[model samples]
Every structure is written in C-alpha cells, then in structure tokens.
Target: MKITFLGTGTGIPQDGRVQSGVLLDTGKNLLLFDCGCGVLGRIHESGYEHKDIDAIIITHLHLDHVGDILALIKANWLLGKTDMRIYGPQGTKEWFEKTLDVYDYLRDRFTVEITELSPEEEFIPQGTEGNCNCNIRSAKTAHTDNSLAYRIESSHKTVVYTGDTEPCQEVMELAEDADVLIHECSFPLGFPMTNHTTPDLLTLMMDEYPLTAKKLYLTHLYPQMQGRYREATDHIRKYYKGEVIIAKDLMVVEIQDD
Candidate 1:
C-alpha cells in the first residue's frame, strides 16, 4: 500500500499546504480520504487523473475536509468516469443530496453513491480485476459529534488515518499495532485548544495510553504549526519511541517490507 499526503494543512491556508486530504494506493485501487478545499487541484498537480480515484472516505463534514468533493466528482465526469462511492458519517447522504440539489447542472451530470458509515463498521470496497483484497474500518473520533478515523489494511501492512481529532482513546485503540498511524497534530505545544491536538496534549495522553504503531506521521497542520514542526515531532519523540514525521504534501509512504 502507498499512502500519499496530498494536502496537510487545515481550513486555514498556508504557503506550502492546502487542506486536509490523503490518497492510498494498494496497487489495486485508489482510496481517497478527506477531499478538502484544494484537493482536486492537488490531485491534478500530483499527476494523477481525478477519475483514477475508486472511492472517497470522508472523516467529517468540516469544510476543510469536504469542500472540494463536488469538484472531484465533476472532474471524474469530464474524464468519462461517472461512478463514485463515498463513505462518510451520518448526514453524509443528506449532505451530498442537498449539495447536489443546489447545482442544477451537476445533479444529472454524474452519478455518485454515498454510504453512511458508523464507528467500528468495516467493509471492503469493490475493486477492478487483478486488484489485491483490501478492507477499511472506521472508529469514532472525538473531534466532533460524528468524526471518524479510518484504518486501511491491504496485503499485510495497516495504515491508520485520523481525520481531525483530539487525542482520544477510541482512535488510539483503533490504531493499535498498525504499521503507520497518520494522525492530526493541529497545533504546537502549549496551545490551548479543543477538538484538535497539540504536541503537549498528545504526549500527555500518550503517557497514559501509549500508541503501539511502528511509526507516527503527523498531518492536518494549522498555520500555528509553522516553524514548529521539528519541535512538535521532538516533543512526541520523548514519549513515543517510534518514527515521527511531520507530513508534507506529495509525500508518499509505501507499506511494504522495509
């Protein structure tokens, strides 16, 4: 499996970052997570066609996460690919329906199937011929009332992608023993915040509930994290003895034997 960090920033824009989005490739299918504001453009910039995405799993309904979903679907239609399966928390179906209702031209331009998922639900997306068997599971995240974190396991390695969450036990438990945990560290140390994480808050929680993943990559950064990436990783390093990296756009990780 290959996980690509398409956009690592949050709602607030930064110079090098766009918004919250990631892509996972199992050499069989492409699974996109959280198509935020600039994600469609980033997909094009990353040299991948928009129609290549097999499915999209959204973590929440936050604008930074779901902003460009329409654009993605539209682009796929332009490329003669009209099928899309979207998995998201409750209200997802309604959200898409309502969004489409507003755009008269888009309502009939393409067809998209939206599935509402609950925490702990797991399913395998339909794949084309000669693709590896892959499965995805979701766990409730504490960022919002309906936020979810996802774990995708294909071939052998597992990769956990936390949408936008505070340091919560449910997400940590869901991520246990995974090869890579891609979590959101939105703020720097000593920043008082809620519904999001800081380096101090994460380590403080890690003191009680340790993360067992082989590596941790932090994404969904805010402008506040600017110039503090190394410090954030160093702080978490003291508590979690694993690879900790601050994810950048276009960074790719291959989940194969190292």
Candidate 2:
C-alpha cells in the first residue's frame, strides 16, 4: 500500500500546506481520505488523476475535511468518470444532499453512492473500477460526535488514519501494532486547545497507551505549528521508540507488507 499526503494543513491558511486530504494506493485501487479545499489540485500535482479515485472515506463533516467533495466529483464528471462511492460518518447522506441542493445543475448528473458509517462498522472497498480486496474498520474519535478514525488493511500492511482528534482510547485501539499511524497534531507543545492535539497531549498517552505503530506521521497542521516541528517530534521521541514524521503536502509513504 502506498500513502500520499495530499494536503496537510488545517482550516487556517499556511505556506506549503493545504487542508486535509490523503490518498492510499493499495496497489489495485486508490482510496482517498478527506477532500478538503485544495486537495483537487494536489491530486493532480501528485501525479494522480481525480477520475481514478475509487472510493472516498471521510473522517468528519468539518469544512476543512470535506470542502472539496463536490468539486472532486464535478471534476470526475467532467472527465466522463461519474461513478463513485463515498463513505463517511453518520449525517453524511444529509450533508451531501444539502450541499448538492444548492447546485441543481449537477444534482442528478452522476452516480454517487454515499454510505453513512457508524463506529466499528466494517466494510470492503472495491475500488471504483478495479478489484481491491482491502478491509476497512473505523472507530469513533474524540473530535466530533460523528468523527471517525479509520484502520485500513491490505496484504498484512495496516495503516491507521486519525482524522482530527485529541488523545483517545478508541483511536489507540484502532492503531494497535499498525505499520503507520497518520495522526493529527494541530498545535505545538504547551498550546492550550481542545478537540485538537499537541505534542504534550499526544505524549501523555505514550506513558500508558504506548503507541504501537512503527511509524507515526503527524498531519492536519495549523499555522501555529510552523516553527515547532522539531520540538514536537522531540517531545514524542522522549517516550516513544518510533519514527515521528511531520507530514507535508505531496509527501508519499509506501507501506510494505511484512
């Protein structure tokens, strides 16, 4: 499985970083997670076509996490590729309907299957036009009531993506012994915030939870974390014995099977 960080920034604007988006190419299919504002262009910049996205897995309903859903679908429509399956937390169906209501011209132009997922729901995503035998499971996150963190497994390679959450037991359980954990670190250490993460808050879990991923890539960065990358990684390194990475736009991670 190959992972590409499409956009790593948050709602706040920052240089070299856009809102949340990630692409997981599991050899046979391309699975997209979170299609924020600038992700459409990043998809092209990363050398992948928007029309090839088989399924979209969204983590939450926040604008920063779902701003480009319509745009992406429209882009695919223009390319004559209209079939897509989108999965998200509860209320996703309503959200898509409400958003499409404003644009009547494109309302019935394509085939979009939206599935609302609850915590612990398991499903198999058969890539839009290919056969990808991958299992996906989600857990409720701590950010929003319907927010979810996904664990994707294919060929013994597992990757956990924590959309945007504070330290939570559900996410820890979902990421146990995974190859990589693409978590969110929205702020720097010592930054007072709720419903988000900082280095201090994440490290607090290491003492007890003990992050089991071999690699931890922190995404969903805010502008406030511009100058604190080293400090944040240093803090996590103090307790965890794994690679800590600050995800950037267009960054790629190839997941190899054991």
Candidate 3:
C-alpha cells in the first residue's frame, strides 16, 4: 500500500502546507481521506488524476477537512467523470446536501453516493471493477461529536489515520498494531490546547495505551509546529519505540507485504 500526504496543514494557513488530505493507493484502488482546502490542486500536482479516486472517506465535517470535497466533485464532472462515492461520519449526507444547495448550477450535474458511517462500522469501498481489496473500520474521535478515525487494512498491512483529535483511547485502540499511524499533532511540544493534540498530550496517552504501531507519522500541523518538528518527535520517541516522522505535504510512504 502507498500513502501520500497531500495537505498537512490545519485550518490556519502556513507556508508549504495546505490542509488535511491523504491519498492511499491500495494497489487495487485509490482512496482519498479528508479533502480539505487546496487538496484538489495538490492532487493535480501529485501526478494523479482526481477522477481516478475510487472513494472519498472523511473523518469529520469541519471546514478544514471537508473544504475541497465539492471542488473535487465539480472538477471530476468537468473532466467528464461524474460518479463519486463519499463515506463519512454521521451527517455526511445531510452536509453534502446543504453544501450542494448553495450551488444551483452545479446541482444535478453529476451523481454522488454519500454514506453516513457510524463508529465501529466496517465497510469496503467499491472500485471500478467491484469492492476494493481492503477493509476499513471507523472509531469515534475526540475532536467533534461525529468525528472519526479510520483503520484501513489491505495486503497484510494496516494503516490508521486520526483526522483531528486530542489524545483518546478510542483512536489508540483502533490504531493498535497498525503499520503506520497517521496522527494529528496540531501543536508544539508544550502548547496548551483543547480539542487538538500536543506532543505532551500524545505522549501522556501513549504512556497509558502503549502505542504498538510500527511507525508513526504526524500530520495536521499548525503554524506553531514550525521549527519544533525534531523536538516533538524526540519527545514521543522517549515513550514509544516506533519510528516517528513529521509528515510533509506531497510526501509519500509505502508499505509492502512481508
């Protein structure tokens, strides 16, 4: 499986970072997670056709996470591709309807299948041929009432993505034994924040849950994280024995079967 960090920034703008987005190529299918602002252009820059995305899985309805969802659908329609499958936490269908209501011209131009998922629900995203060769499980997150974290298993590899949350047990349990945990580290080591993560807060949770993921990639960075990457990674390394990385926009990581 291949994972691409399309946009690593948060609602707050920063240089070189856009917003929350990740593209996962499971060899049999291409799945997009969190199509935030600027992700559409990032997809074009990543050398992948946006129309080829098999499904879009969202973690929440926050503007920073769902900003470019409509833009992507519109872009695909312009390119003569219309069918889209979108899966997300509760209210996904309603949110899409409300958003589309604003664009009178774009309404009825294409077809979108929206599925609202619940915590602990497992489902398969269908590819062009049929169901993709992977399974996805969702867990409720601490960021919002319906925010979720996803565990994707394919080709004997497991990857977990935490959309936006503070240190929480539900996500930690869902990420157990994952090959890579793409978590949100929104603030610096000691920054005081709520509803978002700091290095200190994450390590505190790790001390209790004992993260078993083989590798950890931090994303959803805020501007405060600038120049503190090494510090944050070092802090987490002291508590966990896995490889720690600060994800950057357009960076790619691949996991292969043993």
Candidate 4:
C-alpha cells in the first residue's frame, strides 16, 4: 500500500502546507481521505490525476475537511469523469444536497453516490468490488458529533487515519496494531487546545492505552506547529515505542507485505 500526504495543514493557512488531504493507493484502488482546500491542486502537484480517484472518504463536514469536495467533483465533471463515490458520517447526504442546492447548474451535471456511514460500520468502497482487496472501518471521533476515524486494511497492511480529534479511546482501539497511524497534531507540545490534538494530550492517552502501530505519522498541522516538529516527536517517543514521523505535503510512504 502506498500513502501520500497531499495536504498537511489545517484551516489556518501556512507556508508549504495546504489543508487536510491524504491519498492511499492500495495497488487495486485509489482512495482519497479528507479533500480540504487546495487538495485538488495538490493532487496534480503530486503527479496524480484528480479524476482517477475512486472514492472519497470524509471525516466530517467541517469546511477545512470538506472544502474541496464540490471542487473535485466539478473538476472531474469538466474532464468528463462524472461518477463519484463519497462516504462519510451522518448528514453526509443531506449536506451534499444542501450544498448542491445553491449550485444548481452543477447539480445534475454528474452522478454522485453518497453513503452515510455510522461508527463501527465497515464496508468496501464502491468500484473496488471484484478485487475487494481494501476494507474500511469507521470509528466515531472526539472532535464533532459525527466526525470519524478510519481504519483501512489491505494487502495484509493496516493504516488508520484520525481525521481531526482529541486523544480518545475509540480511535486508539480502532488504530490498534495498524502499520501506520496518520494522526492529527494540530498544535505544539504544550499548546492548550480542545477538539484538536497536542503532543502532550496524545502522549497522555498513549500512556493509558498504548498505541502499538508500527509507524506514527503526525499530520493536520497548524502554524503553531512550526519549528516544534522535533520536540513533538521526542515527547511522544518517550511514551510510545513506534517510529514517529512528521508528515509533509506530497510526502509518500509505502508499506509492503511481509
């Protein structure tokens, strides 16, 4: 499995970082997680064709996470690739309908299959049916009422993406034994924040449940995280024994089966 960090920034803009987006290529299918602002361009910058994305799995309806959903669909529509599969938490279908209501011109231009998923629900994304090499499971996150974290297992490798959340048990359990945990670290080590992650808060949770993921890639950075990457990794290393990495935009990581 190959993972690409398309956009690693947050709602706040920063140099060299866009918003929240990650692309996972399972060799059989390409899945996009969290298509936030600037992700469309980042896709091209990363040498990927936006229209080739098989499915988009969203975490929440926050603007920073869903900002580019319509844009991507529209871009594909313009390129004559109209079919899109979008899966997300409750209110996903309603949110798309409401958003499309304003842009009526683009409403009927293409076909979009939107599935509203619940916590703990597992399913294979559309268009990857026959192979069925990839399976995705969702878990409720601590950030919003319907926000979700996803666990994707394929080719004997597992990757967990914590969209946007504080230190929580539901996500930790979902990510247990994953090969890669792409978690959000929105703030610095000692920054006081809620509904987002800090190095201190993450380590506090790790001290209790103990994340056994082989690799931990910190993402969803805010400007405050600038120059604090080493400190955050060092702090988490003291509590966790896995390889800690700070994800950067367009960076790629590949996991192979043993």
- TM-scores of the candidates in the order shown: 0.97, 0.98, 0.99, 0.98
For model 4, name the residue pairs that clash.
Answer: none
Candidate 1: segments with Cα more than 4 A from true spot: 128-132
Q: Write the per-residue lDDT of candidate 1 for residues 1-258, one digit (tens) a residue.
A: 888899999888789898999999888788889999999998888877778888889999999999999989888888788778888999899889888888878877777878899999998875434333788899999888988999988888899999999999988888899999999999999999998999998998888889999999999998889989999998899999989999999998887776
Cα misplacement distance, residue 198 of candidate 3 (Å): 0.5
Clash-forming residue pairs, model 3: none
- How many clashes (backbone N, Cα, C below 3 Å) per candidate? 0, 1, 0, 0
Ranking by lDDT: 3, 4, 2, 1
lDDT score of residue 107 within candidate 4: 68
Better of 1 and 3 by lDDT: 3
lDDT tens per residue, model 4, 1-258: 999999999999999999999999998788999999999999999998998889999999999999999999999999999899999999999999999998999967999999999999999898634434699999999999999999999988999999999989999999999999999999998798999999999999988889999999999999989989999999999999999999999999999777
Q: Which ten residues in a row have the lowest lDDT in candidate 3?
A: 124-133
lDDT per residue (tens digit) for residues 39-112 in model 3: 99999999999999999999999999999999999999999998899999999999999998899899889999
User: Relative to the unseen true structure, what is the Cα RMSD of model 4?
Assistant: 1.1
Q: Model 3's lDDT to the true fold?
A: 0.94
Model 1 lDDT at residue 243:
97
Q: Provide the lDDT at 181 for model 1.
A: 96
Q: Which stretches of candidate 2 lie over 4 Å from their true place?
A: none
